[model samples]
Target: MAIYMDEIVKQMLQLSCKLEHTVLNSDSEPEEWVLLLDERQYLMKQLDEGILAGEVLSDHQKMLLAQIHGIDQRLQPIMLERKQGVEKKLREIQRSKTAVDAYHEAGPSAYGAFFDSKK
Candidate 1:
């Protein structure tokens, strides 16, 4: 059970890292975000429960934990870059939307009146 749990934790962490990066790149859909958050929360809960239960880990599990820690460390910069890039994209989109909205609001005409009327 401990070994399985260790494997589960490793897989969850890897998925979390990937999803986090995706989110950072503005590539994460709402569903993906939810799934990633859920997995992270579940893994945290499992780790806490396992620790509280004083579970005995096999050698393989111990090794896996260490490996996961190392992988997480290596992923730090990638995670940061992804997050910053996503934020920048979102900000750019928001600024563009605001500018367009302002342009439309300043005029009496609706920007898409022609296309809407023809369709």
Candidate 2:
């Protein structure tokens, strides 16, 4: 049982390290981002399942905790970048909508007198 626990902890640690690497080296490609998020979600689900299963891991508790912290550290920057990207996209969409509305407001059907020469 002890050896099995150690192997499980080792595998979990490896996965955490891999996840951190993936997050740190992420690129601008959309598919890469999707892959990163998918990996994160999968890891999180697996961890949750393990916790729910009441498995007791005593040997590498501190090390696993540290790696989990490291993973969280990597998560912060990615989340911040995502927030900034979404905000920027929202600003762009708002700008586009505003321009369209302004054009419509100044169109010929606008609520105003028709074009007339002040001769």
Candidate 3:
């Protein structure tokens, strides 16, 4: 049980390091971020299961968890910023689409129209 716990913590640590690298060194591509996040979620689930099973973490494991938490703190703001940007872009696209649909519904305008002599 201790060995299994150790392995899980080590893998989590490695993933956190990779996430930190990705956050710092690249453009933070959404696809890559999603994949990493999915993996992290899975590891977290496993960690939770281990804890529920009464597995106690050693000091080293606790330190690794702390390091992961620190990395997460560094990554959170950047991720939120990126998410907001994406959402804003999506809203803009939706608005443009709505305008286009309304225009289509309105149909084409007359080529020419008579002007009123008196207003």
Candidate 4:
């Protein structure tokens, strides 16, 4: 079936906006990156299917598809950067958790009584 590329275009645009926000200072969970990856893959598959079907395209859709392609090209590096940010944040959290575990393992005296030694 012929699908309007605008659907994919809007999806790509949203992804670009997300990448922008993710690159900025904010703590994003790993799931957020996974969502973005899924979106990208879905849009790519839609584009491929539309092309392979040789669907009749409207002028607006053609123009929008071109714009979407342009945005995708510009946003590739930003997506990579955001993916790195996500990975780095996940590692930091894991490392922090490990340190806390080690501190607690040192015994109740080190915790200043906030944690009961008996428990």
On TM-score, who's better, 1 or 3?
3
Per-candidate clash tally? 1, 0, 0, 0
Considering only N, C-alpha and C atoms within 3 Å, which residue pairs clash in candidate 2?
Answer: none
Q: What's the TM-score of each model vs. the native?
A: 0.58, 0.54, 0.80, 0.50
How does residue 92 of candidate 4 score in lDDT?
Answer: 100
What would the per-residue lDDT of candidate 4 be over residues 10-119, giving only the tens digit for each residue? Answer: 67767856754654434765477667768878887887888787866678767766775776677577667777877899999999999788767756663366454343
Best by TM-score: 3
How do the residues 19-65 of candidate 3 rate in per-residue lDDT, one tens digit apiece? 87887765768788778878988988998999999999999999999
Over the full model, what C-alpha lDDT does candidate 2 score relative to the true structure?
A: 0.65
Instruction: Estimate the lDDT of model 4.
Output: 0.70
Off by over 4 Å in 2: 1-15, 29-34, 37-40, 104-119
lDDT of 1 by residue, 66-116 (tens): 765675676577656766877999999999999777666655665555222
TM-score of 4: 0.50
Candidate 2's displacement at residue 8, Å, is: 5.4
